[model samples]
Target: MASAAEQLAANMNFQAFAKATELHKRIWFTLIAMVVYRLGCFIPIPGIDIAAFSQAFQGQAGGILGMFNMFSGGAVERMAVFALNVMPYISASIIVQLLGSIYPPWEKLRKEGGEAGRKQLNQYTRYLTVVLALFQSFGIAVSLSSSPGIVDNPGPFFIISTVVILTGGTMFLMWLGEQITSRGVGNGVSLIIFAGIVAVLPRYVIQAFELTRTGGMNGGVLFMIVVLAVAVTVAIVFMERSQRRLLVQYPKRQVGNRMFGGDTSFLPLKINTSGVIPPIFASSLLLLPATVMGFAASGNLPAWAESWLPGMVGQLQHGQPLFMVLYGALIVFFCFFYTSVVFNPEDTAENLRKYGGFLPGIRPGKRTAEYLDYVLTRLTVIGAAYIAAVCLLPEALIGFAGVQFYLGGTSILIVVSVTMDTVTQIQSHLLAHQYEGLIKKSKLRGGRGR
Candidate 1:
């Protein structure tokens, strides 16, 4: 059966896509939406001095704000309307997920309710996104104006205009992402980040070339960086595809005097059950202090606050020992946290038992749940370590080499993971089309062992 499927996939062509009009439409729509999003990133917000803001960001590179600016595709540096990007939405979604795990009402809504409940939760998340966006926008506006010569006229009008424009931009980006998810080929949020990373790649490469030209960086080190990037990409691909297969056996049953259900299947558990989220969450948390400090540093705050805060913030800078350790710990913590939120071994066990399925070596109830949990825990540990290494290593290397390139492990992971997911979806579509072709051919042949 697998070989047949593989053959079918091999035979798939543009003809299949031509027949799949709906999927084609979706793919086109998604592309168009993404193009629009990229255009929006270039649209500068009104009433901000672009040159001054850019200069401020230059001084603040290696700080948290620069990281945020990178994620937003330089919108933050340009102080574009979409400076907030979809970060507020992501933050709100995380908050809702965390709350759903702890809050009974939200938990019940997640489990007992159906589409209606989901819609309600989504509405709530959107509302929260708007709130977060507004707050962040206000903070950002104040931060920018605090910078000397950033705002020519720092007053209520400038603040209000900036806040409104940023808020609107964020909501627009959020809407664009949702549209892509519903009408496009891949995840909208991920694609946005992928686009941002890809956009920045050329700049990083150029910077590396400049450094080498100036004799600031060794050619050997540049070669090593390239080789290391390729190696990390390969490793990420391997780890992301690695899985633990849990063997399940079904007892034979009589159906209309014929034996059935005596089949076995393996439940595949991914090594990294929580993909990308751990590092993203960890980075956001670790960078929070630096972000605040960056803003505060722009302000004429109390002497004690400025003195003590920047020093503390320096400790959390990208290559600092404290920063790496805390970042790795947070990645591990969120790996476990997000995995538990997304997967419930108890629920899986119950569903399997209800379907007359049992693990090969475990009892069908509590024991199976315990077994699954144990397996997941071990897998999560490995997954967390993989994430930590992939994420922390790049920063450490860049820091040790004293290179100014901006590419990092987290960016590479997102790019690779999203690319793989997109390819898998495309393959699935092709396989389905191939199956449809087989069915049509068999119908034409009319039995007799085609």
Candidate 2:
């Protein structure tokens, strides 16, 4: 049997959507914003030889650059203005999140202060983003200049110009994301990333077929890859929705003329408390070496370091044992690290105590905190293993096939998670629209009676 809410949702149709003016407006705005972002991906940065860079990029496509390129909607390959994309912003956020845990003042601001503090933190992130962007942009400029034929004119002027352009581009993208978040549906940053990943799907499909036609990949392998992607997506959905629910009981109380009652509820903790962040953080950290090397390798390397550098980089290739081990280790580290930052067992216990609520058989203050932490630690171990497996399995396939299917499991996880979140938001908006219509009809009926 369906609940009333479920029944209402089932009954929703074109008529309901047509009635939702705000939803229509938001949908249109989101589409337009996405289109704008896509257009930006093609606007090439000046003073770079596109043809040469494209050819050079092909050689590096099997490595870390491929992953970043996919996330940037091929902007990096195209050497577009948005080539840097929102990666600097993401790096800044990671830094800020880490600081919140270790730095006393930042930790206090994050935990104790509310909305205003968050706004302040966001400001700090933006400033840090500019700094990261400039550093990355300078490296890119230097790399391009050093790489033969990649830059038409290589000098101090080109370096300065490239850094300025890329920094401005990244900042513009950051501002655009903020606007979308404030006025549109879903999370702005995630949606931008989602759009970038989706934008390259057609190209990936074409590439897969091209490989098959060229006899580089057989039909069986292609089919297997397709099946693998579907299986991974299904697994991710199940794991993401899985939760541990802890029962809480409120004691019965008596007021002078009324009875205030006992109520039972559950605190739901998601299996993946860290969400898609662990892989993103891990990948970004791993990518730094490759990305920096790609941008700097063409530049004059010291005679002493040249021999070992290339071999060291080769060892870190995506699917190699060394890379896999480090990737998995980083994912596990960030899983616990991020989960602890966001969810404090002590704070949860304090809030429960303040509200006269207690977990079944547990004291409300320190004891409750201890109990929660114990459960959380166990859950996190399992969650870390799950995330590590999901993120690494795709990378391992790189050795057997040209399965450049969005670089690795991290990209797939991101695409699927963002899609799920967007759909959820749309459903929520539709439900709100239905409520508005019901309220309007009630007001009209009352007026008629009056």
- Using TM-score as the measure, the top candidate is 1
lDDT tens digits by residue: candidate 1, 235-339: 999999999998899999998979998889999999999988887777666555667766675567796697677677677666778778887898999999999
Model 1 collision count: 0
Can you tell me which runs of candidate 1 are displaced by over 4 Å? Answer: 1-7, 438-450
Count residue pairs with overlapping backbones in model 2.
0
**In lDDT terms, how accurate is model 2?**
0.85
Give TM per candidate: 0.94, 0.93
Cα RMSD of all models vs. native, in order, equals 2.3, 2.2
Give the CA lDDT, 0 to 100, for residue 197 in model 1.
72
Collision pairs in model 2: none
Pairs that collide, model 1: none
> Candidate 2 lDDT, tens digit per residue, 1-450?
996679779878889988889999888888899999999999998998899999998877767778788889999899999999898998899999899889988887898778877888899999999999999898888778888888888999999999999999899989988888877888888888888988987888788888888887888988877888888899999988889999988888999988896998899988889988888788778777877665555456799879877766665766777778898999999999999988999999999998899998887899999999999999999899989988899878876565544446787888988888888888889988887878899999999999
Compared with the true structure, model 2 gives a TM-score of 0.93
Q: In model 1, where is the ten-residue run with the lowest total lDDT? A: 281-290
